[model samples]
Target: MKIKPNKLRSISIVKGQLKNVKFCIGDDPIPTVSEQPVKSLGRWYNASLRDKDQVQQVRQDITNSLENINRTLLPGKLWRLQFGLLPRVMWPLTIYKLPITTVEKLERTMTSCMKKWLDIPRCLTNISLYGKGVLELPITSLTEEYKFSKIRLQMTLKDSRDQTISNAEQPIPSRPQPSSERDRKSPTYALCPTPATLKHILTGCKTSLTQGRYTWRYNQVLKSLAAALESERNSTNSLPLRATNSITAPTFIREGQKKPNHPPTKPETGQLAMARDWKMLVDIGQQLIFPPEIAATTLRPDLVLWSPSLKSVYITELTVP
Candidate 1:
């Protein structure tokens, strides 16, 4: 049988993409500039019926994503490997430097691609081929360091025909970190608070209005918390009043956010000050007094304490940096 004719009959394996993919068969293996079948011939997995079902499900998912096309995939690459009907694939003359993106953006792109791959098994892996054909990859892998998700790829086939691998795409972008491991970023100073301290201060804040200090600044606020600490101890039950309006950063890898019912930022002078004051006081005072009323002897100044004997408020000196 002639090689081209056999190639035509060959299973047009287009695997290794995530969702919503289309596959077309042609004389040449490279799908880019090769002849089209007028319309897309549908998905790739030709031989296995079970694989076809998988291909369809993945294709539909990907199609929906592409239609919505708002989110991203990460920590993986969506790679496509094709086997030439003539054996080896040709390095086609195409532009590779498709676009530049931040580490996050590239990750999203690579994620979308992997979702493509997740949709199907990579076509280029584990296949038999005979003739020599060009592998035209617009993208090239410069460093093995970027092992995955950096838009880096290489092409190879078992048989040889005058096969060439060339890079037409622009250079791959660099990684965010020098190390291969995930970068562990600390929480933002504003969003990240010492939970112990916050409880202490909020427990104390309820007394500010009663103490004839309806409106006070940060320094006065600390003293206000001290008074609240004393009151909570004298009471039969002590618990910081639940804050009706609170804000928090909902998700990491995103910005710190105000909790719903959180006071708004408007009219020039904002509630951010109130929030800041509230957070600082609550963080500090709650630790000292934000708990069920307890026997005075069991308490310590480090975490919380009250002295009925001397009638004094005690707080471990805070090291304000």
Candidate 2:
């Protein structure tokens, strides 16, 4: 049966166990014994590595990280990520380094299987490649696949014919299921965005839903975030950052929650709700580089100004009127 959008439920699947999985209202009704639980975050990628050699080293550094995944797969942890009961567990899981090419391949694969465009969130695909690859999956509600295709995808990489997963193949997941193994599509909900639209929304481009020209203005935000990460890495930065996926902000933030900030007081529910609603109205990289001044406003700016000598960024919140 197709997933019901309003009553839509999410299921996390392990490799070779697709048929055994099941979903029900909320996070209730644990999946069957045949099914393994989904981890809270996308598989974590090394953010510092720039090459294969570096990636290999990163793999070594996080040997213990798998403990988290292993624990998470233990049903309890899986439930947390699925329903996001424990947001902290969501970190450390992000796009390690995926190539843009690989990301495109993933998009094609996801859209093809779904048989229609569904907004697969950037955090949900091959987004970790940003470190060495060009793209990473987003961790947002944008993706609501018929099944856990990506999860099984990574598993296929492990069970490679040669047992040596390709770097290029590292990001582009494999489908182990038989070509004819067509799982029933979940109820498709029109209320939310789809994969095709997310492609543009996350980019510095436009979308069918938003008249806000250059709705992807937030790509700069990611651009900025990338730059910050690079600088932080270069500067012997403190503990690194991670996203449940590649990590980002905007509409992707949990509804009614504010971006991480030490506001003097909790934002009023009215304002928080408004921010949440406006977030969906436009799309931009959840993270990007931009001037500090320009970063504050909710409205899109007409122009961005920077001066290296002064080390400053100036943004003009355009007046349409």
Candidate 3:
């Protein structure tokens, strides 16, 4: 084997041992050995052998990357962070030893950047950002990713692989019967008459339904949608339809040919522009009564938008499920 002295560097793992270490290539003394950290495999290792510096470096890199991403002012920042920044962050987490606290801090920083990208208030809970919420978004949780990565790494180890094979070869065991009274008890809620399973809590709890819990949640969502529609209804930017008798200019003509017999038809503006007297009603604190002249229906919708001049009515029913 051949050696390149200039490309080589060394570091002692034991404290106070670097002073006694020396290297030479055929008595041409190689003086690269020191207590300072040496770069190896894209990571820094020092005499102490602690991962503090490496972790700090990784943290700094992540912070800088997030800052740079935030400054770009580009769309789909969430996607960029998820696909671009998170993978790079996960690489170090999987390769290097990092404490949960460090991962949490990094996640907090990332979460802050995500809030900016999403244009949401910081007061929003982290669970709402990563977990199932009223407004579900595609966001990854760093701590969960770290845990999964660790599990994946463990699965690749020789012991784990051997154990997995051994388990697969063994006969399947029968399902265990309830051994204790507590285990045999059917789960139930104080207010709910039925079993307190996830499905019951989410949809089938008669007590919750009668208490208006479902109605409150439905109204909350409907309120936001109605507010947005109200703004659009009041806006004056809607394109008005061209008069039927008005003539439109020709859009195009061939270089050496005469204009066509008929002019290109103007795109139809929606019925919304027909009249500006737009009125909106929402079923919130009070019950919504369907206009008698429009339908005289017993069923009430969440929202109603109508224009008397155009005789147009828009009924919207909001469903959370």
Candidate 4:
């Protein structure tokens, strides 16, 4: 095939330009132009030839797959990710040493998709925290699954190879050492952030979900109490603060329900409601044997209960903000 001048292109893998360089056919130099991330052979080629563009493309494709995969077919989706999507990623991974951050992000995305496929939250993946039979299989982050897959692949290849002269045929790549004379830092190893085993994954997921729910409920209760205080103040408007703490107990009732006496004859409904809500929480604590601990100092709590069952202590302070 005869190639025209406009059809030729070049990519320099080095920092400098490919100046004065040319490809020729019988002394006729072919013109060249520079471009990044040229695509060929179903992969992206870049100036550095590092395959970063290909990796990025693969990552985006994987994300798109996660978004469009059939939600109704749970098992089918699992199989697709495990058998199909994984192999696609492995092809690029084999050629390029991907950054740890990129790998982490991809793993997180996979874990999220897996959770959605199972119709469960992340916490449910760890079965140890929530007990058994909650999930059919333990959910693991993509990185762990990838590592496990790689190991299995390595084992299979090893088993198929002839053992006697295989070592002689390929020299084992030695791990690189630090160049500095200072003591080299020893490597640290840790399990993937998410649980790997099926049992533990379910338990962990449930535990995490439960804790999240608890935190949410706790916040709701706090907001309710705050709102109650605001509403009650507008309704009663006669709740008195300590003499040393405020503008001398509102000289002549600013607004709302009128007080009949100058010396504060009756307790306001808002104050009563505030006390009631606080008491309700206290009663709950008492029932659980984890009552609030009251300090013995003057002007302290009206009610305090102590529980030896839990080593944690809680204190409630009420204010009419």
Candidate 5:
């Protein structure tokens, strides 16, 4: 096949590419050379044949597109990111070996835009948002989502192929439990209750509580429950029965869940200051506990005071908002 000068491009994939190498197409030396990646079949490939260039290009494009988006779109930009931006990135994520740093960069860009869209102040930290119902998904979470997408797509493709040969008699594999008996007995494998597990259980309860006869808001319910628990503690002149043995509850893996409200903008430095003040203010006979876990549940009171004279515990939820 005859190739025109305009259709020809050359690049070196090797380190320290050889110099003075010339090529001739029908006795005409092709002098023009380039190292830039070429686009073909709707995909970009660099001379090194590595995915680095593709990742960089895709990131740049996404960043540009995000910059053009208006911050006033309520949830619309988020929806677009989930459906449009995410789908576009999937192909590159699967085909290219993208570094975690690159993924983090993408996440940071998205997060910055999201915060702007939400009109959230810069002073608010991720932990604060997490405390409330706002979902503060990390960069790794987005990567995990892409991985799931790739796996789902592969499974679908495999299923399609399997259906074509369903008529053929296939040997069924032996049924073996995915988990080993030893694994089940291992300490790591044991289900231990964690703050996360407690949160999940509580959030599930939240859903039920909201739809039930009690039409109270989630925060209101939390406050009411805390107050009731405090009252019980006061009457007993000791820890509430619900709190007994809470420290040694069985542990389990914790999954991320959406919080009902945004956490107050309390920085770690400020929290430390509050802790110091609490230590100084309490009397000799009283004990102050920060973030008292209730009945091993994830719900925590910001401050709890145990008064020996009054024989009661008081719960406090501090707010600087």
Candidate 6:
């Protein structure tokens, strides 16, 4: 191979101190020393040989990208953050060795930007931001992405064809085991006298039932649904009517028989369109009583909508799994 002495750069990496290094190509001295950090394969390496510089560079890049995104006057901020920013951030997180604390800090910055973009209060918890609630929004958590990327990278390394890596003994960490003493005398055990499993804590806990946790969650969902229904019932726009004038073509025809042609008539409007008086009863603070005139039953539904003029009623029941 032909060597270019002028293009070559040299730097000595040592534990105590970096020594002045010189290189030669066939006794021709190459005196250039690369004092600054060098970039190779999208990662920076300096004399220190640590990833601190790379981490700082990544942080700066992310901060600048986030600032630019915040300045742009665009709709679908959440969409941009999820599809655009997250992928860019995950690439670096997957390649570089970063501390969990640094990832958490980056997440905090992203979270702040998200709340600002959504015009939500800063006091809102992170759980509400990422949780699958009644009115859930599309959002991604950076910390979760970081962890997923690391795990994927680990799996790739573990399955690599390189003999050294494949044959090397790697320690696999296990999750912390639950204490037997704590399990027997857990707070939930005192109330329900059952094993402290996830199902019991979420649904079957006697203490949780007495505390109205399930009821509160159910009511929250019911309230949102009822509000939307109430708006539709009170709307000035006419109710959606089925198309009666248009006729659907027959799927099959006999060998000797011809297709029938029907004349088009005026579309039929809904019967409730003429009746404007609509009343609604929601089950929140009090039990929902079904109208005795409509249906003589003891069943207490979640919501009831009735129209006296049309002599029609709509009953709704909400269940969350």
Which residue ranges in model 2 land beyond 4 Å of their true spot? 1-67, 71-75, 80-97, 100-321
lDDT of 5 at 298: 47
The residue ranges of model 5 lying beyond 4 angstroms of the native Cα positions read 1-5, 11-20, 27-36, 71-75, 121-141, 149-321
Cα lDDT of model 6 overall? Answer: 0.77
lDDT value for model 4: 0.51
Candidate 3: worst-modelled 10 consecutive residues by lDDT? 166-175
Q: What is the overall TM-score of model 4 with all chains considered together?
A: 0.36
Q: Stretches of candidate 1 above 4 Å error?
A: 1-147, 150-227, 235-321
lDDT of each residue in 208-235, candidate 3, tens digit only: 7887875776777888998888888877
Among all candidates shown, the one with the greatest TM-score:
6
* Model 1 clashing-pair count: 53
- What is the clash count of model 4? 22
Q: Give the whole-model CA lDDT for all candidates, comma-separated.
A: 0.34, 0.36, 0.75, 0.51, 0.53, 0.77
**What tens-digit string does per-residue lDDT give for candidate 6 at 1-321?**
888776566677567777877778898877534465556777766766778877998899889988988988888777878998888778778888999999999999999999999899999999988877897767878888899999998988789899788756542222234368676454434454455556676677777787676687788899899888777777723555344467988568889998777676765345346556778899888777888778888888889888886698878888886
TM-score of each: 0.14, 0.14, 0.45, 0.36, 0.37, 0.47
Off by over 4 Å in 6: 4-9, 14-16, 26-34, 132-136, 170-321
Across residues 1-321, which tens digit of lDDT does each residue of candidate 2 receive? Answer: 754433333444467333435555565554442333233254422221134443343344333333454444254433333344223322222224433453344434433322222334544434332123345323222122212344555666766676456333322222333344242121112223333233343343333345333433444554555464345334332323222245545445688887776447543332112111111111233333444443555455433434343344444442222
Instruction: Supply candidate 5's per-residue lDDT for 280.
Output: 15
2 or 5, which is superior by lDDT? Answer: 5
Candidate 3 ranges with C-alpha deviation above 4 Å: 12-17, 31-43, 133-135, 158-321
Please identify model 4 stretches exceeding 4 Å from their true place: 1-22, 26-44, 70-75, 126-141, 148-321
Question: In candidate 6, residue 92 scores what lDDT?
Answer: 78
